[model samples]
Target chain A: MKKVLSGNEAFARAAYEAGVGVVSSYPGTPSTEITEHVSEYTEIYTEWATNEKVATEVAIGASLGGKRSMTCMKHVGLNVASDPIMTLSYTGVNAGMVVIVADDPNMYSSQNEQDSRHYARFGKIPMFEPCDSSEAKQFTKDAFALSEEFCTPFYIRSCTRVSHTQTVVDLVDRVEGPAFAPENNIPKWVMIPVNARRRHKLVEHRTELLTELAEGDKYNKVTMRDKSVGVVCAGVAYNYVREVNPEASTLKLDMVWPLPIEKIRKFSESVDKLYVIEELDPFFETEIKAAGIKVEKLERSLCGELSVDAVRALFNGEEYEVESDNSLPFRPPNMCPGCSHRGMFYAINRLKLFVTGDIGCYTLGLLPPLQAINTTVCMGASIGMGHGLDKAAEGMSEKAVAVIGDSTFLHTGINSLINTVYNKGNSTVIILDNGITGMTGHQPNAGTGCDIHGGNTPKIDYVNLIKSIGVKPDNIRVVDPFDVTACMETLKEETAKKEPSVIITNKPCIFADRTVIDAPYFIKEDKCSGCKICTRLGCPAILWDGEKRVAFIDETLCTGCHLCIKVCKFGAIEQRSK
Target chain B: MKLDILMVGVGGQGTVLSSNIVCDVALANGFDVKKSEIHGMAQRGGSVVTHIRVDEEVFSPTIPAKSADIVVSFERMEFLRYADYYGDNTTLILNTQVIAPPSVGDGSAEYTDDKVEEVKKQFSKVYATDAISKAIELGNPKIAGMIILGILAKAVHFKKEAWEQAIKDRVPPKTIDLNMKAFDLGYNI
Candidate 1:
């Protein structure tokens, strides 16, 4: 009964094992795979909802029906689902509804590094963060129980490390949990103002009690060692604190919000110094400090994301250090070789249009060579922000295009597009339909023609959807982005029109769908031209060997999608003749 | 002894089965072993790493990085992540694969082949090897991670029979004969 599981898969197995009857999720990184993993078990009903808010509401309804249900989304997706999340916290729940939210700390596969721990505070729900896959599984199984026990939705928060990292998880959680079903009660389920007002009190009463229960819950544990430095840490930070001062008496919290106040105070008093080591936010530290406990030093530097090295830097004892700085080295994530986004960025940049980008792998379009996108606010904001920027300029500053992924458009971009249509404002929204949601690890979206858990769902035609959203059908054009010339004409046409227009670049994610292209192609170094044209595609596989003064393609990384080949005017990007 | 070791590597390598053998041995040795894996974007040739920790009273699942005694990385390019969990006491088994991150693209930044050597200078005790070449020599070429895992076992007290049993237990029953040989060759390495 032992195996390896990533934090995402472990959550899925935990869902299955928890006897979860309903699993709904909007696929986002560090979160998308949870339901996909849960789907493996035939006992559970799992579906990839079109968007995060819809997924959350679906799960909420399931939970109200007396069956344990769960929904998962990335941190940004949480923003899309925030409306439901905030109110549901007031309505409370029945058979335990768990929401697994995966956060990106370094913005890997995410638009921003908004801390979900703060969200737990905002949503007024208990948030559990597991540092590794094991904790991910255990916490998920524990999440269902805690949700029902408190009669409120429980949050299992995950960071990129915890979500992406594979750890030794005891894989039995999938088979251990029992399927739960609850009896329907309209008075209990309905959230109308009259019933809601009573449920709000119930929610408040539960919150007040949950805070006190945190003091003795099994979720938080204390280990006493030297007792000189009592460090309060949770999630991955706990692992770091344990390593930094293994001898330091520690209070580790798995349930971050509604912190175990009494336990933190006792541990702080017992130890000589108090250092709360949690990631990103000052949640635990602030909570404990508010309880009137004075500490020797508040390690604020431990805020943001903490690597074991950062933690050990504070503790001089045999720390893990890479000696020489060198920025600790970072890999610049780039678009795969044949990325569909590349050809589009080429056109957008060549036209010198001030493009507003949305969250997706395509956001890499802003990187070095391309340097095209002017602004990247958040998910689904491209269209609205683009409209505002364009209207403010009033045709003074060239063409402004809002570039969003198909997944994002479906997530929340439609409303803004509708507003542009209703107001009769001119904003061209280009929906990059890469078939799969690329940024957050290629989770299926409404536009992907596939549902969560591999079900064949009706694909939302971005062109038709926008047309229905009030934009004229003629204003919406489905253009094959692989053809640069066709894209150029469409781009000009969409921008030239003084009305809301949508241009969906229809193509499968070349990396996800390998059949899109085959056989590796590279830039001919001997051609003696570093026009910097191919680099404009912003493909990660293409690198410049500064010493050699030529474009170097990492053959292993290239998908040969031919988007780069099409853009290289010099015939430099020729297909490798095997 | 029961060992729950997470072996991490890129997709083309044998990260799955190598860790499975380690987990299976712990199970066969009657040490209630429970191991799980999440293979996300694995097919995309991205950074792949594992967490395998074997202990007696292992309650919480993750190894907690610094708590890990050994971190076997199939590609040296991903060694930076090891700094999170790898401590002065941890042993590093790395493959000399020079696959660059997505950052080192056409216009973003530049990197040379010597990047792998530049990274090795950062580690505490580096065991570098041409695992791909060794795997090719093993007739499979894909079990490069297994060869690296083989080199890792040299530092730990894992029994050969347990590993053999794990390979036979975890792999498809059809490919058992070949995979067992692959595991044995890895064990010898």
Candidate 2:
């Protein structure tokens, strides 16, 4: 059957058809849907791991137990999983294992556009890049088979364009491979110095064999049209090239790693002039050049995504101007109308505390008019960075606060908080427990009392977790983030403390259950002061009428969490009568 | 025989759903369709866009610059936001609703009529309407996108039955009648 499927969805369908027994992942943009889709197939055991590292190890464990396993995460999540991936490459898998890493070229919902192809090369694993959803399914299924054949883990690199785009995919039936019993080969499974040294040579031999396989027409292909100009590209870039310059001969490399040196050299020789086209990094370009191929080096911006227009402009020797009106107001992503984080951010903004923020929806607090967060490095960097700031700068402990979400705090912030208590640091750590993973479309985490399948799971209690980590019971305070008054008072008391404090902002994301929605709020024009104090909350529902110099709520957009009512000292904002 | 449709709207304005309906309609008519949109942060009240191409064979999921056959704007400013994607031959189906961004609300930026005026002057085949008001009149403001898709259907060559079937296939069974009514309201407009 043929169906419309996004790349991530296709990957899941392919895994199902490939009879994948285990699927594990931590939700991240462009890649979260893969595991989410995988969960629909009851035959597969799916999980939302604490972080990418844990997810990768889970898949690794499943593979060692003689089952085809897969783990999917965004490019940055691969950084956390890289530790296991690098070593797993040495200690080959018992069953087929595939790691799907989706790269965000334009940093769309991501911190950096770090290419995942490098990880495939860094980990000495074969990698495949699919251009569209159809290819995504085919390549993913092929990846599993190739993994088992080579006795190594394989990488399937997807970008935002491919993963998020929906295209027609032809489906197939499940072809379950014969299950192998769990083996007890210590030298093959374990990675000690002696075993690893022997495994290293096997890894090299596998690479050579993979390179030979990549040279064939199976993964890499050459299309000869007008031989005047040819482009060597892969993934989404190949689609742009095909769209803009269809007449040009093309060398589309489905397998990005292992070089495909002979195929690339032959393709280059076939065309009059060959040019390398790719987004972000020039991995293919640099490698093609180093292989003694006479490919032209085109100047392309290493930032952002490559578009069809960009390819046309590159060939025409013209700059692709982004057609945008500067006069138009910018619409940056903001907190929702009744976001639970707003009250906490409003209080933090009022306190003017130096906040070390972590990843998730709370990162939006860095935007005005709240601008509460000061530093955001990675997943759980806030706690560690805040503690480091306190230790390095005198008197900073009293002013520094680390803000993290419940999902992220469980991911890596738990260890950082333990470090704070162990080192006797007085850094204030505020855990924004929104009950669900808010950023990546509300995937359930360890703190959430649900599994990937929405089945009942033991929820991790933050209060007990913090106390067990050496924080005093009195120092751990849980407050409702929607209550601005309580949030402010708690933050004031917590930030001023000379001991390590853990503040848990207990509120479910408004989107999680839509519980924040109530009667719409409105402003009484007569009682309103034009002070714009409610506007400082930066809620999308609140609008500032410059002419009237008064603030009013957009009833259509308002969720009536009564946050603005508390912010309004004049009692101008009131909920409508239901 | 390739048609490139660009749908632009605010994050929660149902642009993704409308584009999916367009894809379904195209597919029902035996055409290959590829649709692309960025999710995540862009979904949080930010300007969102979806590029959809329907043809016998679609290569890139994204429409090339200046080649969008039809531009569906769910909000006025968003039409101007993606001005680079359309040209003189493009037919624009615009929803005359203004959503103020945070910058506009905080008085850091001005939301002016000049942007809408610029869009009107640039495109000769512009079909502007208050779809949001029409949707509200139809009993739910959220069905505004179906109205815009109805206008979009007039610009494209798909059969009316194809659109109706596509809508029925995609929407919830209980709200299918309401959505179909909204689509007809747009088609009549």
Candidate 3:
């Protein structure tokens, strides 16, 4: 059967067809839907792990228990799972294990554009890259065969361009592969110094064998068109290269890592001019050059994504424009109009506190109206950084605080929160529990009381969780962030305390929680005192008519939450009656 | 045989949903289709764009600049932002709706009043619709994208049944009637 599916859906379908018994992932953009789609298949037991590290570990345990297991994450997520992944390469697997990592080339929703192929090389694992949805499905299925063949973890990399793109894919029936029984092999399973040292040699030998297999693999193929220019590309870049210059001879490598060394050399010798067409970093170009092949570098920036026009320009012997802006007004992502974080951030800025922000929708607080955040290193860095900053300076503890989302706090903030209490750091932490992971399209978290399968799970009580971490019950404050006056009062009270404290900003994301009714708020022009205080909240619903000098709310956008109404002391903004 | 479409709109405007419907309709009609979309933070009121290409055989998910056969814009400014995607050969189906960006609304910049006129002058076939107003007339603002699809249905030679089926397949069961009505309004307009 032929079906139109996104690369993510195709990947999940392919995993099911490959007889994958266990699938685990933490929700991240371009990668979240893979796990979500997999959850639809009852044949495959799937989960959204607290973080990528735990996801990788769960998949590893499943693989060791003789089931085909896979874990998925974005490029930055591989950084979190690198510890286990590096060792898993030595331990190998009882059943085939595939770690699917989606890279965002343009940093679409990610913090960085680090290549996942580098992780494959670092861990001594084979990596596959697919150009379209069909290949995404086919390569994913092939990944299992490659994993079990070498008894090593295999990486299947998808970029935002690949994962989010929809294309035609041919569906296949699910294959029932032989399941291995868990055998207690002490030398192979145990990673003690002696065992690890011997396994490391096998890891090296396995890479060599994988490279030999890749040399003749169907994924690494050559298309001879014009012998003058031979371009080597992978993943989405391969599509760009093919579309732009179909006449150019091409060496397309679906198996990116443990590269086809012999085929690359043959292709390099056959063509007059060899070029590497890839987005972001020159991963293929650097490696092909190291393999002693003479290649010409296409004049393109390593930053951002490669467009079809960019590749076409290179093929047509024209210089691609470095910068071409039509002067469109910038539309950076902002906090939603009725977002609870806006009130909490507005309070943070009013108090002039240095806040270490974590990854989530709240990180948007670093933008113009509420420039409240000082640092945003990574996930769970907010609490750890808050403790460090407070200890570094004498009075910084009084002025500095940490803000993290419910999902992110659950991912890594719990450990850091426990550290603050254990180390006796007096840093104030704010857990912005928006109920779901808002940034990644509202995936259910531990606090959301729903699993990946949408089954009702026990919700994590933030107040109790904080108390268990050794903060006093009195010190842990639960406040409705939508109530600006009350939220500000709580913020002031908590920062004044000498002991460590937490203020949980409890509210659900308006978009995610459909139960939240949004009665339109209209501005009373008669009572308007053009103070522009409500405008400072940066609510998209609150529009200031420059001519009238009075603010009016766009009824369609205004959620009856009415944080703007509380900020308006002049009785300007009022919610209309139901 | 090739129809390259570039759909641009603000996040939460159902731009992704519209593109998905078009792709599905094309697939149902036996055309090879590929579409590239942006989701995530962009879903939070940022500019969202999708490049959808359909033909007898489609290779790339993205459409080349200055080569789109048709440009379906849900918002006016976002359409102008991607003006590079269309040329003289391109037919523009613009939803005459403007949701000013923060910079423009804050007096830092100006919203171009002559955008429709400007686009008309550049592209030969420019169909501007008051889809936002049309959607409001139909009693729901969320059906604005469906109205654009109605206009697009006229520009392209696809079966109305296929388009309707695609909409039904993609949208929530409850909103199917409203979306079909919105699509009909757009088709007529």
Candidate 4:
């Protein structure tokens, strides 16, 4: 049967059809849907691990137990899981294992635009890149088989364009992989120094065999069209090339890593001119050049995504003029109308605290109006960075604070908290407990009291977790983030303390819990004072009438959480009658 | 023959769902379809766009610059945002509604009425309507996107039955009637 599917969805369907027994992942954009879809198949045991490292370890454990296993995560998540993947390359898997890493070439929902192909090369594993959803399914199934054949873990690299794009895919029945009996080969499974040294030799041998396999037409294809111009591309870039220059000779690499060196050289020789086209990094171009092959080095921006227009412009020797109007107002992503993080960030901004922010929805706090967050390096870096900032700067103890989301706190902030306590750091850490992973479409985490399958699970108590890690019970305070005054007072009290403090802002994300939204708020024109205090909250629902010099709420956009009402000192803003 | 439809709107204006319906209509009409849109941060009240291609054979999910056969926008400002995507032959179906961004709210930017005039002067074939108000008259403001899709349906050569079937397949069963009414309201406009 043929069905429309995104690249992420295709990967999930392919994994199920390939009879994958175990699937694990942490939610991240462009890749989160893979595991979410995998959970629908009852035959597969799926989970939302606390972080990518844990997810990778779980899949690794399942692979070692003689079952085909898969783990999916975004490009940055691969960094956290890389420790295991780099070593797992040396210690080959017992069963077929595939790591699906979706790269955000344009940094769409990612902190960095690092290419996952580099990871495949760094870990010495074969990587496959699919152009569209159809290829995504076929490559995933082929990747699993190749992994088992080579006795190594394989990488399937997807970008935002491919993963988020939907196209037709052909579905097939479940073809269960060959089952393996558990074996206790210490030298093969264990990665101690002496054993790892021997396993390293096997890794090199596997690479050679994979390179030869890549050289064949199975993984790499050469389209002999007009030999005047040749294009070497992979993943979504191939689609753009095909869209614009279909008449040109093309060398599309389905297997990006372990690139067929001889095949590339032959393709270059076949055409009059060879052009390497790929998004972000010039991995293929650099490698082809290093192989001593002469290819045209086109000057293109290494930033953002490559599009059909970009390819046309490249061949025409002109720039792709992005259709954009500068006069149009910039519409940056903002906090929702009744966002739970609003009041807390409002208080933090009032306090003038130097906040070390972590990844999540709260990262938006760094933008305009309520610029509360000072630094956002990565997941769970807020606590450690805050602690380090306080230790380095003498007078920054009271001014420094760390803000993290509940899901992210559970992911890695807990480790940073333990380090902070052990090192006697005096920084205050605030956990924005919105009950769900608010950023990547609200996936359940360890603290959310739910599993990937929507089954109930024990919720992690932040207070007890913090206390057990040496923080005093009195130092941990739970406050309602929606209540602006209470949030402000609690923050002020915690930052003044010399000891390490943990503040938990308890409120469900408005999108997660619509029950919190009441009647929409409106402003009484008679009682209005045009002080713009409510506007400082930067609520998307609140707009200022410059002519009237008063603020009015857009009832359509308002969630009616009464946050703006609290900020309005004058008796102007009132809840609309239901 | 290839048809490229570019849908632009605010994040929550249902561009994704509308584009999905367009793809479904194309599929029901026996055409190959590919659709592409960015998710995540762009979903939070930011500018969102979807590129959809329907043809005998579709290569790139994204439409080439200035080659969009039809451009449907859910808001006035958003319609003007992608001026580069419009060619002389491009037909524009725009919703006459304005959702001011934070910059406009803060007085850092101006969203003037001149934008609507600019859109009228630039595009040769323009179909502009208050779809939001019409949707609200139909009992729900959210169906404005459906109304825009209805206008889009008239621009294409597909049969009305294909659009109805696509809508029925895409929407919830309970609200199918309301959505169909909204679509018809747009179709007649």
Candidate 5:
């Protein structure tokens, strides 16, 4: 059957048809849907692990237990799972193990545009890149075969262009196969010094065999057209190459990691001018030049996404400017109307606290009005960084605190809590527990008490979890963040303490709750003072009426969370019942 | 005939859902279709743009600048934001609703009153309507996205039956009748 599917959905369907038994992943943009879609098929066991590292380990354990397993994450996520992935390359998998890493070259929804292709080379694993949804499905199944044939973890790289784009895909039936039984090979599975030395040699030998297979890979094709120029490209860059210079001879590589030098050289010889057209870093050009091939790297910005016109400009030597309307007001992502994070951010901003932020919707609190966060490093780094900042400076503990999401706290913040308690660092930690993972489309986390398929599971109790991390029960407090005065008092009391403290702001995200009411708040035109205090919450619903010197809430946008009401000192804002 | 559509709106406006219906209708009509959307952070009341192309054979999921044939904007401010996608021959159907950005309320940027007029000057054909108001008149403001989809259905030559079927296939069963009514209002308007 033919259907329209995004690259992520296509890969998920392929994994299901390839008889993949276990699928584990941590939800990150451009890669979250792969596991979410896979969970729809009852035949496969899919899960949302705590972190990418844990997800990779779970997949590795499943692979060792004789099942075809897969783990996926975004490019930055590869960094977290790299420790296990690098070693998995040496130990290898008993059954096929495919690792899907979606690279965000444009930093679309990512913090950094770090390339994952380097990880494939660094870990000595074979990586494949698919251009569109059709190839995404085909290459996914091929990735499994390559993993089993070479007895190594295979990589399937999908960028934002490929992962989020939707196109036509042809479906296939599941390829049923028996699960491989675990073998009692201590030298292969265990990595002691003597066994590691032997495995290192085996890993090197496996790379050589994979390179030989890549040479004859049918997916890596060279279309001999007008031989004036040869553009070597892979993944979505291939589409740009073809769109720009359709008649020019091109080398489209589906297998990017272990380059088929023999084929590249042959294609390089056919055309007069050799150009490596790619986005971001020159991973291909660096190796191609080292192999003694003459190629010209295209002149383009190394930042953001590549376009069809951008590629054409490089060939035609013409300047291409992407037309944009700069007159429109910049609408950056903000905390949703009625968000629980607002009350805390408003309190922190008022108290003038140095806050270390983590990833999620609350990261938007760094923007103006409630510009409270001092630094936002990455996922689960707020606690540790805040601890270090407090310990490094004298009297800093009284003014510094770490703010993290419920999902992120479970992901890696617990370790930071342990470090804070054990090291005796006097830093306050705030967990914004909004029930679900609020940032990435409300996916279930360990705190959500549900699996990927919406099945109920044991929810992680935050109070006990904090206590288990050695935080005293007296120092642990759960408060409703919508109450701004109470939250401010709690923040002040916790930050003044000479020991580690945890305050969990408990509220469900408005969007996550289906039964949420739309009791929009309106300002009393008569009792209105032009303080602009309500805008400090940074809620999109509140609009400052500069002409009338009053605040007006857009009824369509407001959910009546009442955070703005709490911030208003004059009692001017009131929510009207629907 | 090739039809390149650009959907510009704020998040939570059901832009993705509308584009999905368009793609399904195009597929039902037996034309090759492709659509692309950047999600994740955009869901938090940020600017969201979706590119959709339908042709005998579509190669790329993205539409080049100044190449789109039709643009369906869910809000007035979003209409100006995606003006780059408009060509001289492009047909623009804009919802006459303004959801102020943070910069506007904070006094960093001005929300001009002539926003729709500016868009009208660029594109040859502009159809501006109070889509949200029309959806509200029908007792559900959530169907504002469907109202704009109805305008797009009239602008293009797709099977009405296919569109209705696509809506049924895409929207929730309970909201199907109301959405269909919203679509009819948009189709006639």
Candidate 6:
């Protein structure tokens, strides 16, 4: 049956269909939903690991124990899992293992947009980039088979556009693949330096074989068409280029790393003008050019995010008509109103202390209005940076708050918190436990009090987890951010204390939580002295009556959180009667 | 003429779904359309707005904000956020809502009654709404966005029948009676 599902949903369904034994991932945008969605299948063990690295390791161990396993994270998250990913590349696996990395182009909810394909090359692993939801489902299952065949970990990379977009996919029953029947190759499995040295040769041999394997793969193929134009594209960019020129000769590669050399050369030789169209970086164009093919129109000059418009510009020729406009139309991305982070950010700013931020929708805290978070390097870096900054400050600045989302804290944050305590650093870590991973479409996390199957994993208590990390118990404080006076007072007290601390803000993210009741606060037209005191909260639900010079609240938006009534000293704003 | 438009907003008075109601009504009257939206991250007590432009032909589902005939904005600072999209001929329907951004430290920017008067300097015409008072009298404080939509329906290109039809089609089966009352409350001025 054909079903309309998101890329993440399809990914999870495919994994379950593959009868994957273990699912481990720390929630981050673009990729978080895959694991969460997969948890719906009761036949497999799916979970939100503490971080991406641990998640990768957990998947590796389970796969070695003869279970199909997979772990996923956003592109930046690959950096956190790179260590395990590299070693696993050498160890290979008993059962099929697929590591899915979701990349965000345009940095939608991300702090940065570093390509993960580079890491795949660095780790000497083969990578697959799926263009859409259906491909995300099928390509992942394909990666698993390729992984077991080569005794190497397979990678499937998808970007935000592919990860978030919904498309139709055919549904089939979950066919549990046979268990990883173990075969002894101690030299292959155990890589002690001497044995590892030997396996390194095997790894090299495996790469050659994988390359040969990659060469015949159905993913990397070309439509031998009009000799006028030859193009190499992959993932979403592949779709873009195709849209621009339907009849243009194309070489679309699913397996990007350790590229299918013979196939590329064949595609390159058949066409006259060779153009490479891939987003972010021209990894394909660079590699093809290196392989001694007279390349024409390589996107050497163009860089950054990929879009159909960009691809259209590259293939601009007589066949493609061009229309140019000089308007520099802009649509800058911004955060929403009544966001749980806003009041907390306002509180953080009041402290005037340096704060290292982490990934999530909360990363928008660095943006204006809430311009409170100081530094946002990557996932889980907040605590690390916070510790580093605290040591450098060396008692000068009163506090350093490592602000991280609940999902990010699960992704790679807890360890950094543990490390900070172990290193005897005096810094505070604020686990912004908004329940769901709001940055990447509200994917569930370990701290969310729920699990993949909607089955609860003992929600790791943030306060208790902080203690386990060896931070002093007295230092940990749970505060509700909405209660302004309490939140401000708690921040003041936490900063004054000498011990390292962990503040768990238990406010539900406004987007997800709808329990709150909003009593309407309409402005008094006649008694209304438009002092504008109510506007301080910046709630979009309220509007200023221009002609009469009075405050008005948009009823539709009034969550009835009633923060405005407290601020309205003039008694002009009052709740509407039922 | 019947219309159905969805405006996304957070807990703020300025961006309370007024533009969508009016545009949806306009579409209901001899118009055809559908829209997709993203209200993510905006509910953080920040300025929020989305455009739903309708005409005889709109191939794509999303509204390209540039040609928006009527721009309903709840906040002053947000004007520049989507400023490039507005043409010189665009009507800027505004609610002089100003909330300090993170960049504006407390007490750094002074506020005065003449703030909207100054803001009107840029726009060809600034139609401001005191939606709060009207909502207060109606015993529904959250009706400002609809009030602005009502004001626009009366003044702009959209016909009133389309607006009523849209409300008729969109209001829930259970709330149909209440909503007709609400629609009249919103635009019957």
* Per-prediction interface RMSD in Å: 5.7, 1.1, 1.5, 1.3, 1.5, 8.6
Q: In terms of docking quality, how is candidate 6 classified?
A: incorrect
Off by over 4 Å in 5: A318-323, A515-518, B106-108
* Candidate 4 segments exceeding 4 Å error: A320-323
Off by over 4 Å in 2: A321-323
Alpha carbon lDDT at A414, candidate 4: 92
Q: What is the Cα-based TM-score of model 6?
A: 0.74
Q: In model 5, what lDDT does residue A358 have?
A: 96
Each candidate structure's TM-score, on Cα atoms with residue i matched to residue i, is 0.84, 0.98, 0.97, 0.98, 0.97, 0.74
Identify the CAPRI category of the predicted complex in candidate 2: high
lDDT against the true structure, each candidate: 0.72, 0.89, 0.87, 0.89, 0.87, 0.68
Residue lDDT tens for model 4, A1-578: 77678898999999999999999999999798899899999989999999999999999899888889999999989999999999999988888999999999778788988888989888899999999999999999998889989999999999998899889888999988779766578998888999999999999999999999999868799999999999999989998898898899999999999999899999999999999999988899889999999989687888888988888888888876565567768888888889999999999998888999999999999888999988989899999999999889987879878999998998888999999999999999999999999888888888888898779999999889899999999999999888989998988888899899999988899876779888899988878889988888999998988889888889988888888878888889988898
Please provide, for model 4 over B1-189, each residue's C-alpha lDDT reduced to its tens digit, 9 standing for 90 to 100: 789988888887878778888877887777889999888887888898888999998888788877899988888878677777788888989897989999888756778678678666777699999998998899999999888888999889999999999899889999999999999988988
lDDT of 2 by residue, A339-404 (tens): 889999999899888899999888999999999988888999999999999989998978879999
- The residue-by-residue lDDT of candidate 2 on B1-189, one tens digit each, is 789988888888778778888888887778899999999988999888898999999988898878898888888778887778778788888898989989998777888677688667777598999998998999999999989888889878989999998889999999999999999999988
Q: What is the DockQ of each candidate?
A: 0.24, 0.81, 0.69, 0.75, 0.66, 0.07
lDDT comparing candidate 2 with the true structure: 0.89
Whose TM-score is higher: candidate 1's or candidate 2's? 2
Docking class of 5: medium
Error of 1 at B88 (Å): 8.2
lDDT of 5 by residue, A418-496 (tens): 9999999899999999988888889988888888888889998999988988999999999998998888999999999
Q: Using DockQ as the measure, what is the rank order of every candidate, best first?
A: 2, 4, 3, 5, 1, 6
Give a tens-digit lDDT track for model 3, residues A1-578.
98889999999998999999999999888798999899999999998889999999999999889999999998888899999999999999989989999999878898888878888887888999999999999999988987898999999999998999999999989996567997589999899999999999999999899888888846688999999989888889888887877799999988899888779989989999999888887888888889898988667778888878888887777877635345766888889878878999998888889999999988889887778888988889999999998888898888888999999999999999999999999889999988998898888888999898789999998888788889999999988887877878888888888889999987889866877867889999999888888878877777777788887888888888788888898988887888
Rank the candidate models, highest TM-score first. Answer: 2, 4, 5, 3, 1, 6
